[model samples]
Target: MPVRREHRTRTATRTNCISAINGTAVGAGDHAAIVWPLLCGVAKAKYYLMTADFIGGREAERIGLVSLCAPRARVLGRVLEVAAQLARGSQTAISGTKKSLSNWMRMAGPIFDNSLVLEMLGFLGPDAREGIGAMRAKRAPEFPSAKLPGAAQ
Candidate 1:
């Protein structure tokens, strides 16, 4: 499943960009216990390098941070190849191309939001209410008649 985020696009999301980046998260109390003589920023960064792993690495990709993913044995080689490509390519050209793509698809955000609202509205209708109630009650619910009472007249 893709990571749920309001700030990104589907194509922009690669395996790394989801909740795929495995890392340790410390709550308020835990942070105080281990992180001392260090502020929040430093502590967060320290925690990342210390606890990050590949089990669910794509998590971090949700924000367009991770560039690629590979097995432990080949990660370095893949990184090198990616680095070489970037080095050989025109930085400005790539940047502009990506920027345009992002802007064009960004409008999908509001469309999804409206669609979700419409779906929920449907769920709140009598059909949905009957369907859910029937499921919870362990019986099939009856749907309303497809036609109004006087439609054939």
Candidate 2:
């Protein structure tokens, strides 16, 4: 009973936290990360996005993160070409298709909202304090792995 209660409490806390962030659209990309796990079984999406971990264009394309990579010098021309192609297509059909995709993508909104709240909660904790202090002190942040009060066990 205690374990069940703890789980419920933790879930409620998470939901509330996410709700707060969702209200502001601060975690919109989180929905994509959360859904990526469902569609592509990519569990590291959130971690990669949050940590600003960068992959090269080729690697991103290989992983299906991008359709193609353009050389730096040709990027503008490539983009313009794509835009012109899109503009030449049926605008109404393209708009409707985009809306459909957007609606499907929005299924992750709740999860993203929760993640944002958790992130905001982290900002109010010791780790955030230490991080800010380290930044002000001109040192690297030494984030502790210890669990805080509302953190999941």
Candidate 3:
């Protein structure tokens, strides 16, 4: 099935202060293609996105994917502390800074839109079905797109 046109809209911008504890991070959909590059650099983004590797908290912070990594037990407390500090800051200054930085992402709107279209199209192809089947069967995906013409199975 094709993705609905209305569902292809760009994600809304918001102030994100990511903090990770014990869990890992993986970019879903447009996240790897767009958001990851905006947060980290292209090299790091591509490495992680392409591999679909699980990123630990420390690795995530080192790559600039997260603002901080807190001990699992202290995660909630750390989050509240950061929230409190932000709440004390001047809203006008914070809002303006966010808008300025967000313009960088806005500049990539065309690229993001094109990538999104391609990604959605992939969902309608044979590889998508094979991928899902492989996952359900607990086996590595033998993507249809990876098959070469006249190659024996």
Candidate 4:
């Protein structure tokens, strides 16, 4: 679905003013190791990413993961309004500010790359197969990794 498509197509140059209308947010790709910690905080990011917990829009905003939450019907309009406001500002100033803020993520680039490598390794393992199967079956994954001796249940 849409989440998978988003994960595949997401680009770094996209505007960062995220607004969620409906549905839960899960840490995906480099977002878990890099973007989430920068948006929210380390503790909040760790709690959600490590648990793979789904966070609703309102809670996401409250936790600073999202810029705002809007009603489903109003989401597009709200986003366009924010865009228009940005478009009216001094482009150079906005671009400079954005670039400066993005340096935070740039500093974590090596960590993000390492996490991506680990994520790819996970995809090659049995747990990934179980995770995909569970998603397809609409059930909880009995991850093969969790079955190892002394592993947490």
Candidate 5:
């Protein structure tokens, strides 16, 4: 199924801009270790690291982020179609597959726990304050260097 973000106008998410480029960059720990796996999964983590996680429909489809791509106007129809298809499939198989995936992710529960702590540490840092300040001021954030102890250098 295709999962997409809402971006109907010129305005888009600041997270993408912040993460993709240097002025909008996040430190290695939060982006790489915490947010990456939680949001993009392990296999696609490298691409997100390089792109700062900015992805749209076509790009998402290209990288297997989404199973399908369609114009914004068609998103609902597409979702319905995909849902109907899945609904018609073997209910037991679908449930089993979903259960397996959930179990696999749960196996890494401890890692996710660590990631949350690391991310919270970022939230309490100077850069996080600067990011909020920059947003309020409608200016680009001047991110400080990623110097969190134990973060990759």
Candidate 6:
């Protein structure tokens, strides 16, 4: 019973978070449209538009979605403040330095296998028992840590 409530709470949080980032204009299935541009903004190193005056922007900041935050009404003023500072500074040097470092980081590969390992383990783990139970029960998982090697019995 507690697990079901927790599952619904988590799901609602996820859905609300997505809806906050993506306004109703693009609708549900087309959420990817917003995501691609946001990634492009990050790659090009620009501050992407905040979907909501408060909520989505908060989540974005939590996830490195933006460079800074302003009061919900002060966005333009905040932007101008940064722009004027940058305009007066050494733009060429800054641009070149950023380009070089970003390019270097982008090329660092033999891409870490962290993602693949996590996915594999998440599905195959003995610790995943509760998760699979939740899945079969049409609920979210609540696995115990007991199966992990260092966990206390």
Models sorted by TM-score, best on top = 3, 4, 5, 2, 6, 1
TM-score of each: 0.31, 0.59, 0.79, 0.78, 0.64, 0.34
**Predictions in order: lDDT:** 0.49, 0.56, 0.72, 0.74, 0.57, 0.46
- Runs in model 3 deviating more than 4 A are 1-26, 147-153
Q: For residues 7-32, could you state the per-residue lDDT of candidate 4 as single tens digits?
A: 43443354545443555444454447
What TM-score quantifies how close candidate 3 is to the native fold? Answer: 0.79
The most accurate candidate by TM-score is 3
Q: lDDT per residue, candidate 6, 45-85, as tens digits?
A: 22333232333555556655455655657777777776677
For every model in order, what is the number of clashing pairs? 14, 2, 0, 0, 1, 0
Q: Per-residue alpha-carbon lDDT of model 1 for 1-153, expressed as tens digits?
A: 132253454436422222222234333221222222122344444555344433244543432234455566676676677667766778778666767666644545565455456655867788788877888999967756345577783
Better of 1 and 2 by TM-score: 2
Give the TM-score comparing model 5 with the true structure, all chains together. Answer: 0.64
* lDDT tens readout by residue for model 3, 62-139: 988878888889888988898888889998897688777767767766777777778879889998999999999999
- Write model 2 residue lDDT over 59-110, tens digit each, in one string: 6556665455677676667767777777787877876665555554456556
Which number leads on lDDT?
Answer: 4
Model 5's alpha-carbon lDDT is 0.57
- Model 5, span 1-153: residue lDDT tens: 011112111122212111112122235433245335645677787767644666666776676644567776776777777777778878788766656545644555466567566667979999899989999999987778546588786
Clashes of 6: 0
Model 2 worst lDDT run, 10 consecutive residues: 14-23
Candidate 6 error regions (>4 Å): 1-55, 104-153
Which residue pairs in candidate 5 collide?
A: 18-24
| Global local distance difference test of model 4 | 0.74
